[model samples]
Target chain A: DAGITQSPRYKITETGRQVTLMCHQTWSHSYMFWYRQDLGHGLRLIYYSAAADITDKGEVPDGYVVSRSKTENFPLTLESATRSQTSVYFCARRTDYGYTFGSGTRLTVV
Target chain B: GIQVEQSPPDLILQEGANSTLRCNFSDSVNNLQWFHQNPWGQLINLFYIPSGTKQNGRLSATTVATERYSLLYISSSQTTDSGVYFCAAQTGANNLFFGTGTRLTVIP
Candidate 1:
């Protein structure tokens, strides 16, 4: 489709294991963002990329790594998953008007 | 960094009822947007109102940038309207910040 999509909508991983969530947007938006949503705390930005190869950390970036090798794709990786990292991860793209968010990936680490 | 606060952290309404959600920001903003996260966890864009007011069907939103706040009104609510409504703002620095959101549950 021509919209944003996230893979592995639901995932379960053991603590200390490596995991990656995929995001793809056909709109070719210049700005891509990754956010994690948990109870009590709202959505916190983990990382954002202005364009391919240009990335910056947001409010919460620790324990998360993001790369945008292509304008259409931005993936977030967890080097060593932890129970605290278990949450619903969302991918979004910023346009002139506002943002378009993916369906989200629910990650559970035990 | 700007701070965004949303009022009525949780709300319950009967179908066909009307409700209003409010969002307050700590600083001036250049972009203001309202989003509806459906029950399925899909974030859908509702309105991009930086200033003034706009109405779309049974939903309407108003942003008073100078006053540093905004309001979202939903009339004749439907069961499908149950979800979290988030209000986000882009400050002069060009970074977007979202509020905790208002969780609305509509009962039929």
Candidate 2:
């Protein structure tokens, strides 16, 4: 209840469908990030929000979208899911100590 | 962009054994941290050592900023320690670059 959390621990979607992954933190951290983990790629940032209404792209942000209307929530959306987008997604919040990550969401596209 | 590489892609250790994991960065790092991805896919932050050394229980980490490398030491390994260890680096940016990770298996 005190840390960040992700919704839909596992998901199966059809190609070309739209899907949204929700991330929420209780700390209201100023920075929140979205990353995807693929084999051999480790974890690459997709998008990040410095604060409410300020979102920026990271290394790989194509085909995905993010919004942070409030400090506690940063949701990532895949407009057209593809097989290549199938990977574990993670959400993180920047803390004074370090970045705090949420329980990842394992997504599959068929 | 900074590249973070980890050594010993995979490792297997007996319970009560010890192992060391290494992380190398391509550029000077402003921040360095280590994390453990558990079997349930939770990323648990273990250390945030940009320089010097820090210890917590059986886990300890040392970062030599001058060398651009860091090492994680785990003594008396346990079954619960079986997971993937990842080191991430930041080069004066808000984005953190992660290594491929070292998968460790501690068999009982």
Candidate 3:
């Protein structure tokens, strides 16, 4: 309850459908990030928010969108989910020392 | 963009053995971090070494910022330690570039 948390620990969606993954951090960190981990690729950042209403694209932001309406929330949305988007997604908050990641969301686009 | 490379893509060791994982970055970084991704897919921060050494329990890390490299040491490895170890370098812009990771397997 005191750390970052991602909703829908597991999700399955059909290709071309819209899906949204939610991330909430209780600490209200100024920086929040979304990263997708794939085999052989480690973790690739998809989007990041520096503060409320300020977001930027990361290494792999092609089909994803992000919004930070509040310091405690950063949600990632797949406007049109594709099979290639199937991967384990992690939400993290930049801490004083380093970044703290959530449990991860396993998403499968069929 | 920064490039992060990790050595020993795969490793197998017996329990109680000691191991070291290496990470190299292409450019200068403001800080370096080590994380352990457990089999359950949880990324736990191990160290936040910028240019010094720090230890926690059986794990220790050292980052030579001037050299653009970092090392993570795990002593007396256990089954629980069998996971993917990743090193991430943070730039001045606060973007973290992660290494491909070193997967370790420990057998009893």
Question: Highest lDDT: which candidate?
Answer: 2
Q: Candidate 2, DockQ to 2 decimals?
A: 0.91
Which interface RMSD values do the candidates have, in the order shown? 1.3, 0.6, 0.9
Greater TM-score among 1 and 2 belongs to 2
lDDT of 3 at A20: 96
Better-scoring candidate (DockQ), 1 or 3: 3
Could you tell me which residue pairs clash in candidate 1? none
Which digits, one per residue and each the tens of the lDDT, describe model 1 over residues A30-89?
999998988888888899999999999999999999998999999999999999999999
Q: What lDDT tens digits, residue by residue, belong to model 1 across residues B53-73?
A: 999999999998889999999
Q: TM per model? A: 0.96, 0.97, 0.97
- Model 3 agreement with the true structure over B1-108: per-residue lDDT tens digits: 789999999999999999999999988888789999989989999898888999999999998888889999999999999999999998887578899999999999
TM-score of candidate 3 relative to the true fold: 0.97
**Candidate 3 chain A: worst-modelled 10 consecutive residues by lDDT:** A1-10
State residue A25's C-alpha deviation in candidate 2, in Å. 0.5
| Top candidate, metric DockQ | 2
Please identify model 2 stretches exceeding 4 Å from their true place. Answer: none
